[model samples]
Each structure stands twice: as C-alpha cells, then as structure tokens.
Target: MREVFQAELKSIGDELIQMSKLVAEAMERAYASFETADTDIAQEVIAADQRIDYLQNSLDERAIDVLALQGPVASDLRMIVGSLRMSASLERMGDLARHIAQLTRLRYPNQVAPARLVDTFKEMARLDIKIAHKVTQLLETRDLTIASEIIALNTSVDKLHASVFRAVAEAEWAESAPVTADATLTSRYFERYADHGVSVARKVNYLVTGEWDPELSAALDQD
Candidate 1:
C-alpha cells in the first residue's frame, strides 16, 4: 500500500511538470502573439487553457486519493500539499496567459499600445518568461534558495508595473492616451502573471521549509 501511494505521488509530480510546460508555452505564445499579431497562435493559447484546467482537476483527484488511501505523512504529506499548490498556480497562470492572448485577438493590427509603452510591455513579457522558467526550475530542483530568489524578483516586477501605470497616467494626462492603453493593459496582465509565478515559488518554499515567507504578506500592507 505504501509503495502504491508513493507511486501515485510520483505520478502527480509528473503531471504537474507536464502542466507547467504547457502553461509556460502558453505564456510564450501570448507574448509571441503581441509581436506577430498572430491570431492563430493567440487562439491556440486560448484553446489550450482547457487542457490546463483539466490537468489540475485530474491531478487533484489523484492526489486526494493518495492522501485518503495511504494517509501520507511527513515528507509525503509535504509533497502532496505542495503538488496541489503548484497545480493551482499553474492553472491560474494558464488563465492569465489565455486572457492576454484573448485581448490580443480582440484588437489586432490596431496599435494595441503606444510605441514606447509597448516596448515596456515587451520587457514585462520577457520578465514573465523568466519568472515562468524559474518556477519550473524550482519545482524540478526543489531548491528553496532559488525559490527565495524568484520571490525577490517579484518585487522588481511589481515596481515595473507601478512605473507602467504612472507612465500611462502621464500619457493620458498629456492627451496622448490612445496609443498607451494597450501597453498599460498588457503590462497589467504580465504583472498578474508574474504574481502567479511568485505564488508557485512560495509553494515550492513550503515544500522545503514548511512555512511561507513573511515578506510577501508584508507586500500587501498599504498602511
């Protein structure tokens, strides 16, 4: 029974890795859509989202069965919990990527963002790729230190997002908003995507340390 449960846990890990690859590719496709204005690729991204959702649900069911049948404890407990967290984050990342692709499809060849703002948004997308890559690495290595590093980068992404908002507001106030809206919206989508990456990294940290970082909660503080 223990052996079977262990095998089930390993299967869950495999599925999560597969799911991450799909979601990561979906993100890459989202950015590619922006550059190429390729509605076909964008629609592909939109369509792939269902696969992510289904995988998460399927993984959850197997994970739950393992827990119920074998009653995992100690490290097994941690791995199962972590796998669940990772799947949820990956699922949300897929949703974010799908949204960006949908938004691109809705308004293509129409100057989505101001030239300068679009450039900044492009940078944001590159960062999204970085963050997604890091999330995959952390999962494979289970390196809490690397997870911490990724979490720190999230602050940098947040700063960039804030800067984007300020830039968009200035453009609007200057009566040059028409070209900047797409850029602003794109940056927002990338920011949220980075957020999901940070979330997955923290869950990896949980697998290693059994505790969530305090600084992330601090980031939520407004006072």
Candidate 2:
C-alpha cells in the first residue's frame, strides 16, 4: 500500500511538469502570433488552452483522490496541497497567454502596441517567455536557485509593465483610444503572467524548504 501511494505521488509530480511545458509552449506561440499578427497561430494558442485546463482538472481530481484514500501527512500532505496550488497558478498562466493571443486576433492587421511603445511591449514579451521556461526548469529540478531567478525575472517584467503606463500617460502620447486600451490590457496580461510564475515559484520554494523565505515573500508582495 505504501509503495502504491508513493507511485501515485510521483504521478502527480509528473503531471505538473507536463502542464508547465505546455504553458511555456503556449506563451511562445502566443508571442509569435502577437509579434507577427498571425491570426492562425493565435487561434492555435487559444485552442491549446483547453488542454491545459483539462490537465488542471484531471490533476486536481487525482490529488483529491489521494487525500481521500491515502490520507497523506507531513511532507506527503504538503506535496499534495502544494501541487494543487501550483496547478492553479499554471492554469492561470495558460489563460493569460490565451488572452494575449485573443488580443492579437482582435486587432487583426494592426499591431497591438503603438509604434512608440512597440519596443517596450517586445521587451515585456521576451521577459515573460523567459520566465515561463524558467518556471518549467524549476519544477523539474526543484532547484531553489531557479526559483530565485524566476523571482528576479518577474521583477524586471513588473518594471516594464510600469513603463508602459508611464508612456501612455505622457502628454505627447498620440495614439488613439483603442490603441491605448490595447496597450494597457496587453501589458497587464504580460505582467500578470509573470506574476503567476512567481506564485508557482513561491509554492515550490515552500515545498522544498518546508518554510517560506522572507525575502521571497517580500518580493511577491511588492508585485
């Protein structure tokens, strides 16, 4: 019975890793579509979100079953609870990517970011993609160092998000109202995506260390 329970736990961990990889891919493709105004790729990302959602539901059911049947305690219990939290964050990340793709689709021929703010949005997208991949690595390796790196990347993304607002608020800003709205919404999606990555990293840190680091908590609070 004990061996079987251990196997079940390992299965749950494997599922989380799979979800992470899918999220990274979704973000990559979403950005590609956003960068080029490729509706087809954006459609692909929007459809792919369903798969991530399915995985989250399936993983949650399995975790609940383990809790009901095996009655995990101590570290085992922590693993189950933490897995649930991470899965929720991963699912939200997938949704954020879908939101980005949807915005691209809505704008069609026109680009989402105005010419003046294009470089800023591009940088934010780049950071978001990096943060997603780093999240996958952190889940696979459980290396606390990777979690720290994820937090740092998220910090940079936050700065970029703020810069977008500043640009929009300037008196010289000449973009139309629609462009301004798109900029605000798209920048927010990128910022929230990175924020979810940080949330997952915090959960992983707690799972590994058995206690949350004060510095990590502070960084997330600043978000």
Among all candidates shown, the one with the greatest lDDT: 2
Best by TM-score, which number? 2
RMSD of each: 2.4, 1.1
Report lDDT (CA) for all predictions: 0.78, 0.91
Model 2, 79-115: lDDT tens per residue?
9999999999999999999999999999999888788
Output the TM-score of candidate 2: 0.96
Mark the regions of model 1 whose C-alpha exceeds 4 Å error after superposition.
Answer: 171-181, 216-223
Summarize candidate 1's per-residue lDDT along 115-193 as a digit string, tens digits: 5566767777777777787877777788777666776677777878888778756634452455456566677788888
How many Å off is the CA of 134 in candidate 2? 1.2
**Model 2, stretches more than 4 Å misplaced?**
221-223
Tell me model 1's lDDT, rounded to 2 decimals. 0.78
Alpha-carbon deviation at 144 in model 1, angstroms: 1.7
